[model samples]
Target: MTIADLAGTPAPEAASATARVRTPRLRRYAMTAPTFFAVEYAINPWMDTSTPVDAALAVRQWDALRSTYRTLGHTVEMVEPVAGLPDMVYAANGGLVVDGVAVVARFAYPQRAGEAVAYADWMSSRGFTPHATQYVNEGQGDLLVVGPTILAGYGFRTDLRAHAEIAELTGRRVVSLELVDPRFYHLDTALAVLDDSTVAYYPPAFSDDARAQLRRLFPDAVEVSSADAYVLGLNVVSDGKHVLLPANAVGFAEQIGELGFEPIGIDLSELFKGGGSVKCCTLEVYS
Candidate 1:
């Protein structure tokens, strides 16, 4: 069945009708400018590089997205994009930062491995205690911080061994969730942490065991439609209140609104050719 067919499935009742609303706090983010386009074919399932990406349009869309964050009262830092690194625009993969500590990613692909050093240097210069891991990890692309724990993904671009290294380095509990679908290669693609107590995810992207674990941990999780998931809908950026996602993900946006979040959609269709959306372009830096 298609995602539209699953749209009718009733969402789980929220844990509380009046969930404790937290004030939106200032968020620091890291982003990169999309100045190059080498994605001519699908490296991951999400990209159809053969379709031809409009490089100029991609830059405009990215700029608009950066502007959106600034307009929302957030500080966005930039990491200088290197030549020949087309995928560098997805800044979230550079490193995972939490509580002033950064664990730099050792990318699984050689194409992206150079980004690790640049990100580490940037993080170190910014007063973050940078920790470089020997294991292959894709930074925030596969690691997400929710509440006190780190939700990590493996069985795709990231090595499972990186989980322990990150946990040891950050002293945060790392819960490993295996990604079952190639399209949802990163944890951020399949899951969005809306707040400390809430998350939105696409169940089919994860293994059954992982889904069960997610249910146990986040009972108030919102399940996105398959249609939304197909367009990387759950790959969203959310502060405590506002959620930014792709404009085409109407179903997911509606669901987010119902949960008391202000869902703001921005058109990032051009970048979608590179296998990413809002979350992939944004790396949250926690103080």
Candidate 2:
């Protein structure tokens, strides 16, 4: 069925909803060094601490991702990694940055709660107007920016109440999308915003209503396959023209390239063992 049919909107209405809207390209990002790597505990469905993780390999993979960003002419800033906080390496969970202001995350899990302090300090030091969130929000892990709206995910790591707080804090429109699959707990895991007007997402990760809303809004979105989604392929980072995704996601990479985007695949397998890849490692710091 067509997206218009699914959303119960006229075809013309759906067409207008996805009309091109250009926003400034993102060039700066915040990342945390994976100095301490170990899956001591499982916080998300993707984490299996019972199996051992290669700390040395994880560091090399992370460094490669950072190097990839640098090669693309993007600025990469670092946040100091604490000794015991292993999850801090996924810097996107630290907060959401938009329009030069950062809405720092108040982590839902105690394991990650302390990370808010370091993220806030870095954002403040970087000249961003930092606003600490009152409700539980996992930074950009559950928050994504599309053209003129912020697509937020709930029913997982982030609380729905934070949507209002984030909208008020960033002065942007927030649309809440409920996540259904535990594997795709964070919105970033299931959706990759390629540009202000384009996105790639896994339909099975979202609730029926959320899927319908996505259909209504992004009629031209690429629907990801289960194979790619299984490897955290949808967890990608894009800079308008280039999309950096997991090397294992060959099909998704080809699809992205066919859409006129340069898909740069980087091996983040070791980090994937910790339930994060490209997008999770890099947090956009809007200029």
Candidate 3:
């Protein structure tokens, strides 16, 4: 199989290949972009001192974050800088790709206004369809795929309008949750559903109604702490028994191990400043 095969598309061997090369496999993913120079705003454990030093630490964090996933065996791709769009590198947020189709996101931030179009173009070039947002909904990061249904969060990175749109497009039931904090901007920031019957979350970010719904759906899931959420570690991703977490979530790794997942940590502090974690830096194609 070739890289084209992995992307679920065909590429003429002569057009881009010297010979047939083994294709890279794909995985399921939720995505996001880095906030340019946005590192200045990350919630750091050591931020009481000078601003410049804090900013530098944020960069190191981002590098560590990206490196974490790379070590876990993902084919990570970084988008080049687009002037004016600071968080463009978190390409996964521009849209959600189910299979190989792109669901163009309606960014909640006006500063990221043009990203949808640019991302759509990129998707099309890769031989994928660019699906539009239904009700101004952001993609992957805010839409949690649990079993066959999607639990969408509103108020911070998505809206009810967009929530309805996603449900219609994917033919999945989308339930909305109101975001309770600015710092946990999107659902991925506060909640992570590891499997149909398993989930991890940071309680304070959920509204009373949302919390009730979560409990009803995943009563048996392992409840993680807020500090682990800060590292965005429980944003738990799996590659067989190998689970990925943020480097800072060393303690969380222990918990994942107890659950039968071999914890693998990645340093992504710099990328976190733009408000993203392990789930954001990856694009997976689960066939």
Query: Please, what are the lDDT tens digits per residue for candidate 3 over residues 1-287?
Result: 53223322233223222312222233434333344545333332322223333446655655554554455465555545466665665655677766455688787667676878877776786678888865676676688777677778887668878877787777778888887877677787677655554577877788999888888877765667777876776555555445556666756666655665455565556655556666665544444
Candidate 3 has what TM-score?
A: 0.75
Off by over 4 Å in 2: 1-26
Model 1 misses residue 13 by how many Å?
A: 19
lDDT of 1 by residue, 1-287 (tens): 32112222223334246545546767999998998755854669877756888889999888988887887789999988888788889999998999777888898888787888888888888988778887889999999989899999998988999899999988999999999999899999999988877899999999999999999998879999899999999888888877888788888877876666767777888888888999999999976
- Indicate the residue-level lDDT of 89 in model 3: 56
TM-score-superior candidate, 2 or 3: 2
Query: Which residues of candidate 1, in runs, are more than 4 Å off?
Result: 1-22
Worst 10 residues of 1 by lDDT: 2-11
- Model 1 / residue 39 / CA error / Å: 0.8
Q: Each candidate: how many clashes?
A: 0, 0, 20
Task: Give the per-residue lDDT of model 2 (tens digit) for 1-287.
Answer: 53223222222211133334333354888899899978888988878978888888899889988877777678998899998898899999999999877898998889888899989899889887679877889989999998789999999889999999999988999999999999998999999999987889999999999999999999989999999999999999888876788877878877766666666777778888889999999998764
Per-model TM-score on C-alpha atoms: 0.91, 0.90, 0.75
Global lDDT of model 1: 0.84
lDDT for model 3 = 0.62
Reference-based lDDT, each prediction:
0.84, 0.85, 0.62
Q: Candidate 2: lDDT of 178? A: 97
